[model samples]
Target chain A: MQSSYFTGVTTSNGVMQHDFTVGEVTGALWSSKRAECAPLVLMGHGGGNHKKSPAMLGRAQRLVVDGGFHVACIDAPGHGDRPRTAHDEQEIAALREALETGEPVGPIVVRYNAHLAERAVPEWRAALDFLQGVEWVGDEDPVGYFGLNMGTAIGVPLTAVEPRIKAAVFGLHWPEALAEYARQITVPIEYTLQWDDEHIPRESGLALFDAFASEEKTLHANSGGHKELPRFESDSAVRFFVRQLVRPSIPQPDLVW
Target chain B: MQSSYFTGVTTSNGVMQHDFTVGEVTGALWSSKRAECAPLVLMGHGGGNHKKSPAMLGRAQRLVVDGGFHVACIDAPGHGDRPRTAHDEQEIAALREALETGEPVGPIVVRYNAHLAERAVPEWRAALDFLQGVEWVGDEDPVGYFGLNMGTAIGVPLTAVEPRIKAAVFGLHWPEALAEYARQITVPIEYTLQWDDEHIPRESGLALFDAFASEEKTLHANSGGHKELPRFESDSAVRFFVRQLVRPSIPQPDLVW
Candidate 1:
């Protein structure tokens, strides 16, 4: 199994944040300072966003502090501290131009994010391998994935092949390159879609949600544009993780001790 | 300006239940014992269910105890304590035969429920008028309506004509006769749909959700058959009402006292 190299650790508001690296991947882990062991949740940051973006930190805080689970987020390729390649620069420029010119950014975003997913999926698997090896972040129970927008672009493929991830919260992406992967995912899913998304068509969001093969999937379609995804959804996702991870049938030896 | 005739009152588990009548319409109200006045939520029970069915009582318990709101439910015409007419009996027989013979019950249920809605809508208005007149159940803020199946049938039209309802939680019914009324309703809405419902087609549910003219609406589609709606949705609805009714801007004068 690949090993993660720990760099720094900090505690704030009762949550312990650990900075770690797996090969070239840069990530941060947040956990309750008091819990002995908890299920792990891997979150993928959006395009142009870092692992510790406010959205990621906020969700991680809830997962760690409220859910009593270890949460980790890795910066997507060409984002955050990672140096962007010439290809990344070119695609980003095109996307910016499309947005500035009032042209549809869907094609460019779908094409670019799909490329990033190809690279990030392996990094996520390796990170999980290293995270589960830690005594405090045991692999006895299944892990979960929560991501949206560009995060959803990468998470769909990651959750598809990652057997360790038993549940996921994913949405706000088109099905173009992701629906096939979504169909392969059979774990419980909580998906969010904006009813009046300016970029992604409503049908596209619904279609992607429909592609998921999970027997226990939920689609939460709110009446707003993409970025206006309500804050309450974050709380709902945390509760979902609690229900899926803290099952009464499973004996949590780690939690007991 | 009608007055409610109180028939009985009981308290259990920190909740107060009031049995009342407006003219011939019988109903029950639930509220927290300590709170002087809170927002009111009117619930419509499912077909073949009474005002205080298990679903109604359980939801009322949460709304009253957890949400700090008064909840009321009335017996639809020819339901609960009311006597069923010959027409009601014939329709009931048709629905029962369809269910027992493994035949489609949608047509019969839709036709019968629509008939009930016509009678139930005015009764609900009278109940609301009477309930609002009570000292403890103030009408300062807009009320909420929650119902599914037959409840949705009654609620769609009731909400259309009753401008006092600012929010509603509706689902588990076809659009058929309800879509026109749904379009007239511009209040915030939370709708639920079973992905694999046998009676209602997926498109039918989606279409009904689409018909709502509410600018702020949500569709929660879960992967389950018609009778398998997850219990957590009830909690979600309670939170939604809290967001709508207990707003920061709306000075809750009733709650202050």
Candidate 2:
């Protein structure tokens, strides 16, 4: 119900920014919305897009409106407001060269994703620290996390290693990665997949389901192609988040059909 | 793969006069495949078709080869094998009544599916009883079940109440009904949904996901329209069944890129 934007100035380590406002429930303590002792949802975007992607925005709105949660999405290193560094092109070229060599490239891709996840964790931690100081929200709410595609690559490892994130959701990403990370997580999780998504392939989703460790987990299959966000699924995601994060003490009305 | 066919006089229960055998796989038993189980998947024609639906045939073939499951497809109660109990004018009138009242109404359509599922369970039990008397697959092997479309409506509930069924897959049915019955299930399940499916609406698929309770559940999304199986998803279903029932002890292979 309430809205505003805050700019996170660049520090020596990285440039941080929170472009969205806290909702009516979380207020100034948006970042602390998840757990009283935990960090907020550290959202990351997919490739070739910034924090304001329509898909990301739709997902974020569902989390805020239906889940009653606060989110902090940042541009990954070398993405969004942060200017590209000299190594960016080299990093791209190196990836291309690896592909050109026609080697068994699975592990190489995994390692690259791991590096990206590791590099993004510090900024996420800093963002959490900044959220703790905000006046609107308290420090007690639990922190849950989610990301799309490449963002999931970052969020998965960070949530696995970071104790602050108690629950998470990974969308538009391979389920196999989640399966590998499932062993490392002690919290509840929601895994979503597109039935017709050609981009990621359905087998990856199955692999992820096989790997999940949590006793309480859900696999939501909706009708849509890759990158297509049907309204029905968006609504389901919100309810899933609310069920995972919102405390029973909070009286919330149904916001989605 | 072994194959055979059997034909005999119909029983009081209208047992099929013809019986056929498909190939078999060696592994642990699953739903309908118990050592004493002669579980059979029944294929249902979608609409405007008889027992010769190729789409239904494709589904049955997948179950046979990938799932190592048995199948029996018959026309709706009065549709193919059985004699027509009503006139064309009467059937059309009944259809019009159903359309007008927004309720299923017709002498030929008198909730036959529910009865079919109820009847099949005992038949399956008898088949299992017969199989136990034979020397082929041992009782320790897994017995499982599966179905498509209208057959899904019957098979799912039948599997839910039938204890011998270890695992089941349902393709192209109402999600809401599946959700209603999902609460009764205690075995692993695989559900497939097509994102751009032109036949069934998206809401129906979501309703099923909302209701499913299997802890080990997989949902496959594909890009094609209804009745057109996506190659990747179909392959995933085959692998899923093999993983769940055939090789429960073996580690699942990493998803092929």
Candidate 3:
């Protein structure tokens, strides 16, 4: 197996960030400056986003500062620091044209993200292997996955196959190809969707949430467009991780709003 | 309008309790022992429950101690200290029979709660009128409603007509009688329902949530039965009120787990 190693490290706002890579895949790890061995949360960025996107950084900060958990996010195949293949270019142009022409983007996003997941899931497992091997991210604590949109695309399959992921937060994608994977996932889940999502139909979003076989799944459907997923949801996701990853054993930290 | 006055006062666990009456109606108010002028939250109890039920007290404590908000709950007509009418007696017996025979209780609960709402709405308004008259609970700040099951039935209608209620957290009831009222409500809302509820159909729960015209509504559907709503949801509701009521002016408080 290819090894993972840190490329650089930076600290800001009380969070220590380490830029790292698992073979060719670029990733970032976030933890409190006052770090300790804690549970790990693997976050997946959305379509057209990278490991250090503002959304990813903000959520990582919350997980680190509030949850006291080590957080990591890898660039999806053809996203962020990764180079795109000819096939990836073709899908990107097709998605762009669909958006420009007022065409339904669900089919294209679903198909393209599904294809990416096949490659991305294995990379995530490899990344997890290296992450768990690290001294700060010891394998003793259960791992968690937090991702939405294209993140959900890759995460559904990864969590389905990855027994190490005890809980997940996923939403904002079509269920056409992912329902099968979602069914295999029996861990606790928190799924979010937009009630009036312009890109994804309401029924389709609900269908994906319904497909989760996790006995303790929760669906948070907010009334808004696809991009209007409230900022507060990020806070809620932090709480979900705190509840799922830390509990009866550790004294839970107060959630700083 | 019937005037309301406090009949008794007590303090426990840093929460000051006030027993008050509005005409024949009985209700309880909860606040921090170190009281101040702050936002008000009107919480409603579930079916066969009263103002100071365990659930109500638990939630009220969170609002008062955590959110620094005054909280009040009134006994529904024919509940707690109120006398039951002959009609209330008949409905109670019918509901009991349905439960014993493994018959569908949704229809009976829907019909009974709606009838109760007709009387309960006025009493709630009267209680609010008196609550706002108190110096500590001034009318300047927006009011919030929190309730589930029978509480949702009464709260939906009460929120529809009460212009002071700017936000609400309601759920766990059918749409048959409340849909019309829900359609008229335009405030922000947080609704909850059970995904695998034995008593309420999943679609019916979704449908009731659908009828709400609030542009900023959220549906929190968890995987559980009618009575198995997770306790953390109460904490979520408190945060909802803090965000809706506190805002860019008052810095949000830390959420203690």
Candidate 4:
């Protein structure tokens, strides 16, 4: 195992910004005592949270420890040291106003939010580009993605536009638009739902699943509620991603504590 | 196709508290629907939500409409029209306190909340008894469960304690204690996770998945964040549950829109 490295770097996305890279690669060997890179998995956190979110970090750790995948996580726009755009507060106020007026917020508002939430994808792509340009990491290393809530909301759409992502695992959020996006994705994908998740009704989950065009799809249900992370099937996620991204010829090492 | 029926009754501690019966039953013809008897699926909702939560309702709809299974759903304590109990408030306070303290909270808290949430499961059981007493429902119908966030927390532990539930689908939440509980579960199960769920971190998901004892398990990652629901996958969940609960000899009808 190689020692993990953490560095803060500035990247341009039509604007200059700082983001953190949390792993290291050495001469065709990707290693981070904390993570491994067969297919580097980039993670995005939800709205109002950062890459340090307990949930996000938990997933990051899982991808690193169990899946043997290196993770590149970043805070999205209006999140984690990033400045909010002029429309950010305005959009939030509009949502609040819509809620107060009891006016049915239309899909346009949702679309707008989704668009804003994904503003960082360009930056993420740049970061991935920089990673790919690294001398130590292999040039053809596959890339995977994992995003939560708003992260999923933005990431799913990004997946349609960015084809480098080889596989993905999306958690909690599953919207109708995902159907359109799922049709565009060629990578193996996994989607999970929280049965009693009051925040985003289960119908949304059903709709997203119905949208996926992949035959490699799988689903797991645990006996827990929406607020908790799914315990019964998380490791399977690691296994699935590793199996798809890592070279199959390499024997999986027996996991030891 | 059989006509669907809806009725409300009360129960206590796995027994009926009332004798209200509104459907007809023959040797194998059960209740208001003419569909063949299949396993009974019990569904529960989360706090401030009812059995009709879009997610919960959609799941039940899938079970009934697509899976060709019978579903019984009820609002838990302090939820829906059910009266709140002191224990409910206490549990909520405890959860908040735990979160505030940064202490590790697991499925046990969710299970404890479930006990408090549906202090009236007994009443629901009574209703189940009434349904079972009907000629068509059959006394030996297999039983399964599906619950969302809070509903899952409650249902998982209840299913663990009650030997009747043969299988289950737990959405959103994955608790740490699940590894130990997985050992106790003798039925087929599935769990869902949002890779980028903002509400719950992925680490918690890993802790929960590590607990599962089921050998026959699968995980799916859809492209969405936490707040959104996975409506597209509802059919996949229904398909899984149907395979687990419904016998192949019974001709299942196509899903109705």
Most accurate candidate by lDDT: 3
Residue A105 of model 4 has an lDDT of: 47
Model 3, A1-257: lDDT tens digits are 68679999999989999999999999999988877989899999999999988888888988998899999999999999999999999999999999999999999999999999999999999999888888887899999999999999999999999999999999899999999999999999999999999999999989999999998999999998998888889889989988898882465223211
The local distance difference test score of each candidate is 0.89, 0.54, 0.91, 0.58
Better of 1 and 4 by TM-score: 1
Misplaced by over 4 Å in model 1 are A1-3, A248-257, B1-3, B248-257
Error of 2 at A19 (Å): 3.9
Span of 10 residues, lowest total lDDT, candidate 4 chain B = B23-32
Model 2 chain B is weakest, by summed lDDT over 10 consecutive residues, at: B21-30
Instruction: Please provide, for model 1 over A28-133, each residue's C-alpha lDDT reduced to its tens digit, 9 standing for 90 to 100.
Output: 9998887577788889877888998888888888888778889998888889878899999999999999989999999999999999999999988888888887
lDDT of 1: 0.89
Residues B28-81 of candidate 3 have per-residue lDDT tens digits of 999888778898999998889899888888888889988989999999999999
Off by over 4 Å in 2: A1-40, A91-111, A175-179, A199-201, A223-225, A229-231, A248-257, B1-257
lDDT of 4 by residue, A46-88 (tens): 6667766665555655666566665666667666656666787
Root mean square deviation (Cα) for candidate 3: 3.2
CAPRI grade, predicted model 2: incorrect
Q: Each model's fnat? A: 0.41, 0.05, 0.41, 0.11
Candidate 2 TM-score to native: 0.45
**Of the candidates numbered 2 and 4, which has the greater lDDT value?**
4
Clashes of 2: 41
